[model samples]
Target: MPQMMPINWIFSLFMFIMIFIMFNMLNYYISIIKMNNKMNNNNFLLKKNNWKW
Candidate 1:
């Protein structure tokens, strides 16, 4: 029998890649949420300043 540990290698590499993908996705959503909050604040500020117009 020949041994190169192919099964474990594939499983571990796939797991490593998936964890990386998940971390990137989490970072993207956090940025999006922060941007959305800023936009909302700006809108409120505009309305507060332009109440006569």
Candidate 2:
């Protein structure tokens, strides 16, 4: 039973690290998508204003 303890600890640590990395990647992509949307909206507004003139 004692020999199995270290293995469990290592596995738990690995799982935690993997989860953290996945969360960070998701956040990064979300921010990038938000920036892209903002850029697209700005371009759309600019085109609309030009047409009004």
Candidate 3:
């Protein structure tokens, strides 16, 4: 039981770190997608304005 306790603790700590990194990566991708959409929208609007001229 004593040896098992250390193993379980280590496993839990590893899982926690993995989840933290996953969440950070997810957030980073989401921000990047949002930025891309903003850029596309701006470009579209600019193109439309130029066509009118």
Best by lDDT: 2
What TM-score do all the candidates reach, one by one?
0.70, 0.83, 0.79
What ranking of all candidate models by TM-score puts the best one first? 2, 3, 1
Each prediction's number of clashing residue pairs: 0, 0, 0
**Candidate 3 per-residue lDDT over residues 1-53, each given as its tens digit:** 68799899999999999999999999999999999999999999998887543
CA-only RMSD, every prediction? 3.2, 1.9, 2.3
Query: What TM value does model 1 have?
Result: 0.70
- What does the lDDT read for residue 8 in candidate 2? 100
Tens-place lDDT per residue, model 1, 1-53, is: 24768887999999999999999999999999999999999999998897554
Query: Between 1 and 2, whose lDDT is larger?
Result: 2
Per-candidate local distance difference test = 0.93, 0.97, 0.95
Tell me the spans in candidate 1 whose CA falls farther than 4 Å from its real position.
1-4, 49-53
Looking at candidate 2, the ten consecutive residues that score lowest on lDDT are 44-53
Once fitted onto the true fold, the runs of candidate 3 whose alpha carbons sit more than 4 angstroms away are 50-53
Error of 3 at 44 (Å): 0.6
